[model samples]
Target: MEALLGIDLGTTGVKAAIFAAVDGRPLASAFVDYPLFHPRPGWAEQNPADWWQATLKAIRSCLEQGARVGVQPSAVRGIGLSGQMHGIVLLDEAAQVIRPCIIWADQRSEPQCRWMTGQVGAARLIELVSNPALPGFSAPKILWVREHEPELFARVRTVLLPKDYIRYRLTGRMAMEISDAAGTCLLNVAEGNWSSAVLEAIGLDPALLPPVVPADAVAGTITEEVAALTGLLAGTPVAGGGADNACGAVGNGVVRPGLALVSIGTSGVVLAHAEAPHVDRSGPTPRIHTFNHAVPRAWYLMGVTQGAGLSLRWVRDYLGLPERALERWTDLDAYELLTREAEGAPPGCAGLLFLPYLQGERTPHLDAYARGGWIGLTAAHDRRHLIRAVLEGVAFSLKDCFTIITAQGLQLEQVRATGGGAKSPLWRQIIADILGVELAVTNASEGPAFGAALLAGVAAGLYPSVEAACEATVRVVENTAPRPELVTLYARFYEQYRALYPALRTVFHALAGLS
Candidate 1:
């Protein structure tokens, strides 16, 4: 059987998976973790070399596992990539790394964001890119570097996003796909190409950015050297994959309109597929992002919650001493123990709410200075209450995105849940009740990796098109319907959750200054 390989370069790790091209059956998979560096507060950076090495390890391990399962490396016909979006990796003329990559979590570009808003009026800026200029985007990072590190900026020859950099390493070519390019804030999202106007407004040359193509297009082939390193056949085609969220949508069979995807990984996102670009230019603050989809001639409306699973992770590491002890005793994962404890607590956690702004917020608020904490905490609140409140808070945050999506007149017929948090039934029910929508868990495992492999299949001619691939490979595995009583309860609490951010806005800014 022919096999396709997918590689995901995530914020925390590199994952590689092999899937049968015909029906998307998973054959083998491997993951290798990497460290995220915080050289200073509000800054996140990673070495391109580290990503390359980790990817090599992951690919070799995946191939070995496939071999053990009777799938040969030679059977892998195509490769695709998915990765963390909006990271800027600079290279000199010789394609040598100019500096460590400034990643999606970095917040050092607020001033540049403000400057861009001033140069090209906020409304015009949104008109050009279909979203507001934010600190985490590539355009602001480019401005930040040009102003702060002019000498280094002068030496820069090419700019690539996180996964595209890996593509360069594997194929010896520098190119980017539309879905990932849309996040760069340099792309004309509606047109599915780089915006020369935005580049000119920021005094950046168009030559610095790589060419953009559709996600399923063949980017390049695996070179002999990379093939040797990963035990893959030379001349294997590599498809231009997508931004993680876009690929995740494809993996979950969210290729058409009316199907929404809620992803809860290190961050949270609510996305809906759009047949045409739906730009919300009426709002003074554009809360939703409209980006080119991985599916050809389509778009997606997305709202992001910067801290989703990260909140649960924080509770697990910092406040789950009992759960940790139990984990050692019972061999249960700390998250499992924590969620089990939380399941005992009543929904809404007796009026306690969490903001989940530990890494700041994106949808609705767009404040980089936002802070996260538990509100309405009293002596009556225990660890169970805290854990349940965190889960409920993330669901509420996603509900914020759902509100924006519906406001745009996009009907959400089905909501598919994908990511680490979606594995928990309790959390899935919470999200369903909070959003007032039925939730589904698809048969597709490995989310973005699976989508990448499907794209690889299309590029390799194993599938006629993206829709055909999804029709053949993706299926709904489970469903969770909203409970009316819980939905009413969550509706009341969601209002309370919404009020906390505005009330604490000034205080959060003040605390950020003090720090």
Candidate 2:
């Protein structure tokens, strides 16, 4: 039986999974964690060598698991990769790492973002790239390096995203795919290629970028060195995988129109597949993102919330839940305990609301200066109310994305849920009630790794196309419908949630200045 390997270079770790190419059933999986460096406030970086090391460790562990399950490692037919998007990895002429990779979470390029917007003209920038300049994108990060570290920028011969760098290390090839490249603020999203005009505006050469390809296309074959390191065949094909969210969408079988995906990890994303590119640059508010989908020739609309699960994590650590778990020597998760506590509180949290902008917000509002806190809190509220309010706040933020998507003329029939937050029945029900749409849970638990494996199956010709591959492997496992009474109650609370941002904008800016 032919098998496939899918690897995800995630923010905090690398995950590797082995799957049957014939039916997409997961055979074995392994994960290896890595540290994210925050040398300064609002700055996040990771050493690329650490990612490669983690990838090798994960693959070997996964192969061992497969062997114990009676699957031959040599039967692995193809490899696919998915990872965090917009990270800038610089390489010298000899393909040596120039510096540590600046990841998507870093917010140090705000000044560069403003400079790019000024140089290209805000309206023309949107016209050329189909999105506004933001601090998290690759273009601004490149400009930041050029202005701040001119000597290091001069040595840069090539720029690659997080996964493409891994692909380069695996295959000895320099290439990128459309889905991940779209987030760089360099791609002409409508044309599905790098924008020369934008590059010129930023004084960058087109040669600095990698060759773009479709997400499912075969990028190259594994090198002998990589094969010897991981115990795999040297010539195994490597597919041009996708960005994490794009692969997650593919993993959930959200390839066609009308179906949407809501993924809540450290950050939250609400995405809808589009038959054609839908650019909405008319509004003053930075609302949604238009990017090439992992499905060839297709597009997607995405809205992001920078702090989704992060808010819950902050609360969990603040409440000493993990420490308490350690003391009891229990295998119970801190999030599960938090969710159980939330269940004790009534819906709406008796007028208490939370703003989940711990790392600033992205969707609807593009304010990096925004801060998070509990509003409408009273002496009557307790820990249950605080936990419930956090959950409701996240749901409310996603609802903001849903409202914008509907306003853009895309109809959402059912929302497929994925990621760490989806495991909670309470969170799923809360999202359903808040959005007033049914929530679906898929059978694939590995998220992007499963999607990457399916894409590898497509590249190997095991399936005729991506859609067919998803249809063969993906299935809806559970459904949650909204309750009428809860939906009515959330409508009023959502109005209050919407007003908090506008009222706090001035105060948030002032607080940021003071800091």
Candidate 3:
């Protein structure tokens, strides 16, 4: 019984899932969490060593579970990796980690972003890399380190993304997959390689970057050392995996045109598959991102909400203390308890609105200084209204993504939903109605990990191609359609939601300054 291993290096944890190579059914999985360090406000960092340790434990536990199901370690034929994008991990000459990885959520590179725009002309930069310089991108983070940590930066011999660093540990190889590389603000999206022009303009050494490879290509084989540690077979092929969103698109079967994916995880993304690169160069800075897809020769346009599930998490931690206490004695989850209460609130939250800009605004706004808060809060509103507003606000922000995709003439015939937040029935209903589209959930519940497994299947010859693997395995098991009355109400509320951002833009910047 041949199986595939998919390892997802997420922001908070690493997950190892074993899947049947023939049909993409998950066999066993294990997750091990690591802490995210924020030494200063607006800065998110993680030790790559933690990721490596957690990954080994997760794989061992997953394989142990698989063994109980009659699968052997040697049964695993291939491995695929998926992870958070835009985070930078620098390795010194001795292959030693020079500093903690600056993750995607870190916002310390605003000045570097300005420097990028000043050096390479904003419009021309977009034309070169198919996206604008954002604080979260790898290039800006690199620049930040170059200036702020010059001593450490000088020793940087190689730069890797979160997952690629894991791959290096597993295989003793260093290469960046194209899909992940595309998010670096250094890759030429249409060409599927590092952009020399962008590198030159930014004064970055191309040599510090790894060779680019296709998502399904065999990047390297697992080393004997890794196999000994994790019970995987020595020389097991490891596919060049992708960024989380790219793999999520593949996992949800959004590989071709006319299909889009809506993922609500720590962050939120509305992505549409495209055969050709689509750049939003109309504005001073492009609103959406055009990145290479996990599927070879394909591209995707993605609109991101910096805080989607993160916003709800804030409420869960701070405001739902009662629910958390109750959870100790009950089987109901704390989030579930909150959502049930939120369901009792009216559709429009009685005119309350939430802006899910807790981290910062992405997609249409592209403002890292923008902060999150509730608008139209009144004495009449309670916790239910606030909770519901968070849900509705996330949906509305995603709608901002959907609206831009359609306006650009991308045909989104179907919307597939994935991620932690998508599991909520209430959130799904809100998103479906707010977007005025039927949201479908596929059987690939493991999200990016499952998608990574499918990519492994292709690399290992279990399937002919990524599309064929999806055609064989992924199917929509549930659908949530928009209710007409709710759709009308959300449409009105969404207009008001749109207005709040622009109105608060100046104030948000001011608040950011004060902080």
Best by lDDT: 3
Write model 2 residue lDDT over 264-336, tens digit each, in one string.
Answer: 9878899999998887654863479989999999999999988898889889878755355456646668888
Better of 1 and 3 by lDDT: 3
TM-score of each: 0.98, 0.97, 0.98
Candidate 1, position 352, lDDT? 96
Once superposed on the true structure, which residue ranges of model 1 sit more than 4 Å away at CA? Answer: 323-329
Task: Tell me the whole-model lDDT of each prediction, alpha carbons only.
Answer: 0.91, 0.90, 0.92
TM-score for candidate 2, please give it: 0.97
Q: For residues 299-408, could you state the per-residue lDDT of candidate 1 as single tens digits?
A: 99999998899899889768755845585658767777888889889999988999998877888788888999999999999888999999999999999988988889
lDDT of 3 by residue, 391-437 (tens): 99999999998888888888778999999899999999999999999
Model 3 C-alpha RMSD vs. true structure (Å) is 1.3
Global CA lDDT computed for model 2: 0.90
Candidate 1: global Cα-lDDT?
Answer: 0.91
